[model samples]
Target: MNLRKEILVTGAAGFVGRETVKQLLAEGWKVRALVRTADTNPLAFHAGLSVQEVGDIAAVADWSSLVSGCDVVVHLAARAHKTGEGPNAARELFRRVNVDATVELAKAAAAARVKRLVFVSSAGVMGDFSARPFTEADPPQPASEYAISKWQAEQALREICRQSNMELVVLRPVLVYGPGNPGNLERLMRLVASGLPLPLASVDNRRSLLNVRHLATIIGRALELAEANGKTVLLADGNDLSTPELVRTFAKGMGIKARLFPIPPLLLLAAARLLGRSHDAERLLGSLQVDVTLKTNLFGALPREETLRGLIETGQAGR
Candidate 1:
């Protein structure tokens, strides 16, 4: 935690990136935020922070100057999962950004003699749902184009770092929800705030979720923990919530009363189909959990209440 230590963070204007940079700065690390452009980046001027405009991840001509003199690199940029694209098109794009560009950056970091490279991977690399809690020990079962790309990136990074002797930390985090990111959590927050009757009560499912700040802390830990070097860790907030539980928690976080009623799972699915929200409904009812039982966490959990508070302080419609 020396004040002189410096870090390079890609996707520095992103949801997790902003918080990660803030955390590192608060902990006495100088940060160089690699952003797409100053026009779109939201980070304010800070003495300890510097902004560098490097366009799209896949098209960046070189990463040598970007990563030079930085002790650590936290790679958080990737092609997020989206629909309405052809599978072939999606696969190629994902590979370019998630795999090709990632390995490119890692190679530059190694060549620059960066001390550590922390990769933010997706738990989707293990598939959407698991029969039990997932662990790093589980074999990757990437089913989506995006997840496959991340898996490939992790593989390439390990080999690249091994040859160069740079430390690599791969983190597979499940369902990270916070202020600016769009996901099931944001939409659910709107529904809960709308004061509509939600028929998600009595629904039983557990999803291991992480706060952006918690994941940021873990990213910092990856730098400090020698035990975490060269290891892939599955991270969660260490608290799993059922659908109804999540609704209630979000409601409480928003200071709204949850209006949940019991509806059979089949009936809910049928209603979702009628409303053309079957995909969202399925995610609401599905169970995706991970084991965050790692001994090197060093920091404790950030409660659901704190995550909700973050939403109030920093929610942005689109970023």
Candidate 2:
């Protein structure tokens, strides 16, 4: 029943990757971390980790050598943000890193005889902004290039696993937030700290979120559970927070009062389009909540209130 064996973790320097490695080590697994750069001292504090410098996930030579003898491979690296690029360019970049490189690594891991491959995919692959909560059974209707790339990567891994007889477990996690989170969550916190009366209060859309610790724990369980093989799981905190509630909670967590303004969502969207920032508006005002019934049924229901409290406490301490 012990799944703790030699494991290779791609993107070991990243946020999720680092957390995964730490948790895996705590579970008494021999972890071999693949890093793009030689300067891995930041992650050198952990014991029983064999660090290897591999240039790019796609062009890395001898991937079989890196993963050979490993029992599992956890792929976590990808092109996350679009930045200031056109849709085509963004799609190409995502394809190169998220799709093509991911498939190559999965293939290499299977070739190396790795027992299981855990892919960290995004929940965004479910579809566009909608009022309905997405479940694993929902047909994928990817809206953006990033989502498409993730979908393609999932298919590639599934196909490779089918042919190579490798156990594949895919995880679709919602907006993962925690300490040291350097994404839109951080930006929102900063905005709240600025004491600006935001118009987002009127938008009543629920969103699912995952704390980093909970995500790592679920991943650990997935690695151990035999039934998780060839299964895709959606991971979330099981509590859907509205836009206003999230802002208020974040403010409360930081010991600050939120200056909220109730503004029409349609007007905000129009303004964002006029300002050439429709993407920002869509991400903030959009509705993309998910149903965690499958995850709860498989991993047991996570303590939602406790997890949210931990997130707030961690955020406050970090600030």
- Candidate number achieving the greatest lDDT relative to the actual structure: 1
Q: Measured by TM-score, how close is model 1 to the native structure?
A: 0.90
Cα lDDT tens digits for candidate 2, 112-217? 8888999999898997676688989989888778888999999988999999978999999998887777667777778887888998879988888888878888
lDDT by residue (tens digit), candidate 1, 1-319: 7668889999999888999998898888999999988898999888999999988889998899999999999999888866444333567889999999998899999999999999999998998787899887889998778788889999999999879979988899888877666656766777887889998886888888787888888888887688888788888877777878777766665667889998898898899899887767778988899887762354456676675555444333311
Residue 80, model 2, lDDT: 80
- Residue 208 Cα positional deviation in candidate 1, in Å, after optimal superposition: 0.6
Per-candidate Cα lDDT values, in order, are 0.82, 0.82
> Could you tell me which residue pairs clash in candidate 2?
none
| lDDT of predicted model 1 | 0.82
